[model samples]
Target: MKGFKEFLLRGNVVELAVAVVIGAAFTNLVNTFVKGVINPIVGAFGTKDLASYTSCLKGPCETGPAGEVTSGVLILWGSVLSAALQFLITALVVYFVLIVPMNRMAARRKSLAEEAVEAEAKEVKLLTEIRDALVAPLR
Candidate 1:
C-alpha cells in the first residue's frame, strides 16, 4: 500500500496520466478536423465520406443499404488514406509542439551546466596558482 501510494504520487506517474488524457483529447480534435475539414475538401472530388471510397478487387462487388460489403473483395484505400493523413497530422503536431521545444530546453540546460563546470575549473586553477606563489615566497 505504501509502495503503491508512492508510485501514484511520483512526478512522472502524474505527468504520464496527464499526458494520456491530453493525448486522447488531441486525438479527438484531430479526428474531428480531418472528418469535418479534410473530408469535405476531398469530397469535392468525389464522395464526402472517405470510407465510402473503395476499389473492388473481384467481380460483383456489392454493398448493402448500410454500406456494408455484401459480396466481393474491397480494398478500402480511402479509409487507409484517411487514417494515414490523421497519423501524419498527429505526428507533425507532436513533433513540433512537444519534441522540438523539449529538445531545445534540454540543449539550453546542458550548455548552462557546461558553463558552470568550466567556470568552477577556472576558479580552482586560479586558487592553485595563488597557493603555489605564496608557498614559493615562504620557502
Candidate 2:
C-alpha cells in the first residue's frame, strides 16, 4: 500500500495522467475541426463523408433500405484516406507544436548542467593543488 501510494505520487505518473487528459481534449478539438471544416469541403467534391466512397471487388454490392451494406466486398478507401489525413495532421501538430519544442528545451537544460559540472570540477582541482602546495612546504 505504501509503495503504491509512492508510485501514484511520483512526478512521472502525475505528469502522464495530466498529459492523457490534455491529449484527449486536444483530439476532440481536432476531430471537431475536421468534421466541421474538412468534411464539408469533401462533401462539396461528391460525398459528405469520405467513408461513403467505396468500390466493390466481388459480387454486386447491395444496400438495404437504410443504406446499410447487405452483401459484397467493399474496399472503403475513402474512410482510409480521411483517417490518414487526420493522422497526418495530428502527427505534424504534435511534432511541431509540442515534441520539437520540448526536445529543444531539454537540450538547452542539459547543456547548462554540463557547463556547471565542468566549472565545479575545475574549482575542485584548483583547491586540491593549493592544499598540495601548502603540505609540500611543511615537509
Candidate 3:
C-alpha cells in the first residue's frame, strides 16, 4: 500500500503520464490536420489527390487486362505524405515553442539559484568570522 502510494505520487511518473496523454492527443490533432488540409494540397499537385493517388502500371499492373493497382509505392505514400507533413510541423513547433524556450528558461533559473546559494554561503562565512572575533576578545 505504501509503495503504491509512493509510485502514484512520484513526480516523474505523473509527468510521464501527462506527456503520454498529450502525445496521443497531439497525434490525433495532426492526423486531422493532415487529412483535412494537407491532403487536399498534395492532391492539387501531381495527378489526382495525393491521398488517393496510385500507380497505373503497364503490364501486370492496373492498365493490364482485368487488373487492379495490385499495390504500389504511391498507395502507401498517401498516409506517408500526411504523416511526414505532420511530423515536420510537430518538429518545428517543438523546437521553437517548447524546446528552445524551455532550455533558456531552465538555464536562467539555474543561474539565479546558484547565485542565491553563493550569496548565502558568503553571508554565513562572514557571520562566522565575526562570531570568532567576538569570542577571541572574550577569551
lDDT of each: 0.95, 0.91, 0.76
Best by lDDT: 1
Over 27-129, each residue of candidate 3 has an lDDT whose tens digit, in order, gives 8887777777777666677543555544434443333356444543224465566667889988887799899999999999999999999999999999999
Clashing residue pair totals per candidate (backbone < 3 A): 0, 0, 2
Error of 2 at 39 (Å): 2.9
TM-score, one value per model: 0.88, 0.75, 0.63
**Tens-digit per-residue lDDT, 1-139, candidate 1:** 9999999999999999999999899999999999999999999999999988888987889989998889999898999999999999999999999999999999999999999999999999999999999999889
The 10-residue segment of model 3 with minimum total lDDT is 55-64
Off by over 4 Å in 1: none
Root-mean-square deviation of Cα positions for candidate 1 versus the true structure, in angstroms: 1.7
TM-score of 1: 0.88
TM-score of decoy 3: 0.63
For candidate 1, list the clashing residue pairs, or say none.
none
Off by over 4 Å in 2: 1-14, 41-48, 129-139
